[model samples]
Structure formats: structure tokens, C-alpha cells
Target: MTLRNIKSVQKTLGLLLTVFSSTMLTPIVIALIYQESTSLVFLASFLITGLFGLVLWLPAKKADTEIRLHEGFIIVASFWVVLALFGALPFFLLPELGLSVTNAVFESTSGLTTTGATILTGLDELPRSLLFYRQ
Candidate 1:
């Protein structure tokens, strides 16, 4: 509840965000090897997510504190939400999928949460990199 603890959570989330952004790179590599044309989408997603992470991290990183349990829960939830949004970027950007932002969010959330539910159809026709990320 203290300002320091909150700062710790922010710092942790920021670091986590940066780390999470790196996950996008794998799909980028996949796109490169497979020539899926979605490489740029993954790259853009990586840069945007990385920048967002730094924006959240750099300001609060100087706090130099440990995260408390309550703050840990908050951080976990915040990270999941932010991660889902970031995860949906490629789906939203890809023209072939024809996914709205809302549908993209639903897909990303479902994948990340392992809910096995999605609004997407024709997965067999989707790009491999996208499918790999969802899987």
C-alpha cells in the first residue's frame, strides 16, 4: 500500500513487460523462415511493446523496493491484461484475418489464458506464425 511498494510493482511490471516483448521476436523469426509476410507485424509489435515497457519501467525503477503480496497480485493481473493487448496486435494488424480489435483481443486473451475459446475461424488457413503464437 505504500508508495514504495506500488513503485516496486510498477518496476516489476515494466521489467516483465520488456521480457514479455521478447516473446514476439520468436514469431518474427518464424515469419522470416516461413516468409509469411507478417514479419513486419511482429517486429512492429515488438518495438511498440518494448517501448511501452520502458515507458512504464524507467520512471519507477529508481524506487529500489521489493514487491509485496497484494502488489504481486496486482502486477500479475496488470501484466496479463497488457500482454493480451500486445499479443493481439498482429491479429489486429493482419489484413487476411479480418479481425476487429475486439476479436483480436478475445483471441489473444483466450490463448494466453488457455481458455481454448476463440472467435477465429478457418485456423487451417491462418498464417503459421500466427498459429504458432496462438498455440
Candidate 2:
């Protein structure tokens, strides 16, 4: 992609980041409604990552709709990478969230890719809220 195309892609990324962040709020809201302690972890993560995602979306306001395949790839990959990076923040904050960086990324990718695997064990002891998260 040309420099112009790349610029456009960056803008779209910012917009997507904004959207991704908004959606993340739902889980946080759910946690709070039930007065679950997990809400604290979710709140911290929500504020940090949501603000970061807003930063990603800033350029999009002026971006053009036309974008090349190369630019599209860059945008999509960056979004997912940023997602996984920010996604890891929550796991670190809430270890009971039960995922390492590798495991989290693998599961995220696996779910998107539909790659079935077996590794997660002991669903019984996990709290109801966390179990809902697993689903």
C-alpha cells in the first residue's frame, strides 16, 4: 500500500479500537451488577484498555473509506495484536482469570480460527462469574 493508503488504514484502526472498547464494557457491567469482586479487576482493565482503544480510534475520524489489501491486513493484524496485548492486562490483574499470555492468545486465536484443543481443566471449582467468562 502507498503511504496514503496506510494512513487511511490507521484511521480505520482507531475507529475499530473505539468499538472494541465499548463492547468490552458489557462484561464489566455484568460483573458489577452482581456485586462480584471480579468487577474490580474488570473495572481496572476496562478503564486502562478502553482509553487505549480510544487512542487507537482517534485518527479514524478523518480517514477515507478506500483502503488496499495490504493496508487492510496491517489494520486487522494491529487490531488483534493490540487486543491481545491489552487483553493480557486483565489476565495479569486477575490471575484467577486463569490464562497466561500464550494461553490467552492461543485461546483467542483458536476461538476465532475454530481450532479445537484440550488444555483447560477444572471447571468445577471456578466461580459462576468466571465460568460465564469461560463460555
Output the number of the TM-score-best candidate: 1
lDDT of 1 by residue, 1-135 (tens): 777888898898888889989988999999999998999988998899899899989999898667667887898888888889988988898888889999999999999889999898898988889989898
- Top candidate (lDDT): 1
Off by over 4 Å in 1: none
Candidate 2 regions exceeding 4 Å error are 97-99, 111-119
**For each candidate, what TM-score against the reference?**
0.92, 0.73
Tens digit of per-residue lDDT, candidate 2, span 18-81: 5655544656667777666776776677687767666655755566778768887887888878
As for candidate 2, its clashing pairs are 14-56, 14-57
Error of 2 at 123 (Å): 2.1
**How high is the CA lDDT of each candidate model?**
0.88, 0.63
Model 2 weakest lDDT span, ten residues long: 126-135
- After the best TM-score superposition of candidate 2, give how far the Cα of residue 73 lies from its true spot, in angstroms: 2.5
